[model samples]
Target: MGPESAGSAQRSHVDRLYHLPMITPQGGRRSAMVPDVEVDFGAGPTTVPSTMRYVDLTGNGRIRVPAQGAVDWSQLNKLPECITVEWSGADRGVVEAVAARQIRFLYWHDASGTVDLTGTGVTDVRLDGIGLRSVRLPESARVLLLREPPESLEVDAPESGHRMDLRLFSRGPDIRIPGGLSRVSELWLKVAGTVSASVLTGLTDLEELRVSFDDPPGVFADAQDLQAHRGLRTLQLDDAYDWDPGNLPELPSLRGLEINGTRRATATVVKARFKATDVRISIHGAKSEAWLAAHMSNPFRDWVEDSKPFGAAACEAYTRARSAIEALAPTASDRMAVAEHALRGLIAALNAIDAEYQLIDTLRREQAGEVFFELAAQAEVPVDQARRWFADRDF
Candidate 1:
């Protein structure tokens, strides 16, 4: 037989069941002996062609894969491991800035009532003034900073890589560092909030730090009183963290120092003797704040007991909401709805809070208008008081 005849005869029993790559054009002929380019083993042993061979296989052994006309499973095999996944558990989010080796820095704006950022892989988050309920950074994260109040920004060390800077943006000097993160490989820590007790338990290995106190009470007076930063060689005390300049210390190993007293520390005795090292002491409170720091009231008196970890704005909002509700008349209905809606489902729990504002916040996010109307319609309370209470709110 000729080559064409042999080819046609061998493809007589070729079937499309098992594997079908492409049907042969010759198989369209009148003779049943025509060959088929695409063929499988379903046609029995007689369908075996002399061409294309299969990978090593024998007996009942089977490996379901995408090869030799099988379905492709490469995508499934390429998925990253579960450990590299970040789960931002909370609903409301403000993923202001996100940077990763796998993707470009994703800067997101928050306009939606509820922001969801559960898909950011192995999150390395950095944000400021974002109104998020919470954030969870993966263990693969290098640097996970919650510059804004993130309610609770949980960082599982190995998930992120924050070698450059980790800042907690607060208008004051107070912050909470996770106790779990025993060692911070980061080089600089500029906290814009209060540095409460044990909050620095995680920064045993930081190289440089500049912490601001939300409460400029000057209680953190002595640097020696601070939980020592073993690797710390430089320090910066903003007006929030400064006490009396005399109380400040200049370490022998200190390579750089910035004692930003501005004007707030001038009255306190916040002296810095950076005689031996390369320390830069900049007084940045009154003069440094050459411009006055905006006088903003504290927000948290109930939601986050000064001891708790959460966002300052969250507390501030709650505080404002409660104050407004107190000044409001009980008849306000629309205002109540706005507050409750803002709470979504936390209205009841918030109401249970001793600080009436927590519950009022639920109302604020819901129908705060109701509260205002009620207050306005009331004849008993002074109307001017209610007006001042809601002066800063969006209504």
Candidate 2:
């Protein structure tokens, strides 16, 4: 697939497309050490004026250069706090020239052809565009980002104690997370094709993960079986419904789940299944009450109507409980009296039942213990009794 689609285009083009004139800072000497410079590029020929306008991005010690065509930063020998270069043209000698500046942190934004970084000395670099050649990346690289998927990727870096973050949007076949990418703590992947779960198998130390699939049928059929990534704390899934529900791996540290493009009904059911897993789920998009009711733990008349057994000695009790629970809001006169009374009677009938209902067993088996506890609390009954009632029999 080419970059013609809306979702698959380069991020810079999607966000900010530069068409203005390029500005190259020019100054012979300064009294107090010059910290940063802002360079902007246009479509015309390269012009290095003796003086140019100064623009600040973050209002700090960082250089923000947005330009086109070849760039030369060879004069900057002293490393600044940070350097950001945004260009749409590739220059084979630009990396060597920038290396002479001894940059500490670099933000390279390019949309043209590939640029080589064989001997660049930047400790942290965020490479943008799709033509990045990783073989030339220095071993001193600590933080890296392929803003877009690369045609050729080479994993080379020293064994430093620093943790790295790798973010990329890739739809290519040749790109793969190199096994040598050690100490990677955060990984963000936006994919468009089939990918295996094993790509993330060895990333045990990963703490944050965000994955989005642009394919309609979903490409991560193999990624559904998450293989015990205990360190993962935050997982955001976008348009990823290829994985089967109820098959998620046990993540002890996982606490936040952000999901998009998943049906609300499925999200509700899955959230109930992981209630004991203690994850805070945030489902995006519109939601309906029907989806919410499908996963409710409380026994209702609907279940009885569906030929599902309820723990009611009298059918009227089940009917009453169902009506009470389903009511969106009670009238000011009745308030919750109708539902509360129905619940008391329903609990009494349930206590007298000797046979077990499949609904209760299903709730317990799915680890939706809190739902029952909430029901008990709403019914003015003890939670311990509800827990014991749920634990009474097996399905």
Best by TM-score: 2
To one decimal, what is the Cα RMSD in angstroms of model 1 from the true structure? 24.5
**How much lDDT does each candidate structure score?**
0.38, 0.50
lDDT of 2 at 382: 62
Off by over 4 Å in 2: 1-82, 88-92, 100-124, 128-133, 136-142, 147-152, 160-162, 173-175, 286-395
C-alpha root-mean-square deviation, each candidate? 24.5, 22.2
Deviation from native of the Cα of residue 20 in model 2, angstroms: 22
lDDT for 140 in candidate 2 is: 68
Cα deviation at 234, candidate 1, in Å, is 2.8
TM-score of 1: 0.38
The sequence of per-residue lDDT tens digits that candidate 1 reaches over residues 1-395 is: 11222222322221111111221212223454533232222212222222212211111112222223332222212222111212122222213222222321222222222333444543344444345543444434454455444445454444243443455554434456543355665433344333443455655557766554434432344446443665666665544433455644434555665543335446334333444436544443243232233222332322221122322344444445455545554566566454433332223333333242222332233334433435344323345544444443531
- lDDT per residue as tens, model 2, 10-124: 2223122111122224446643444443333222223222233322221121343334334335323222432433333355345665576544455555534544564777665
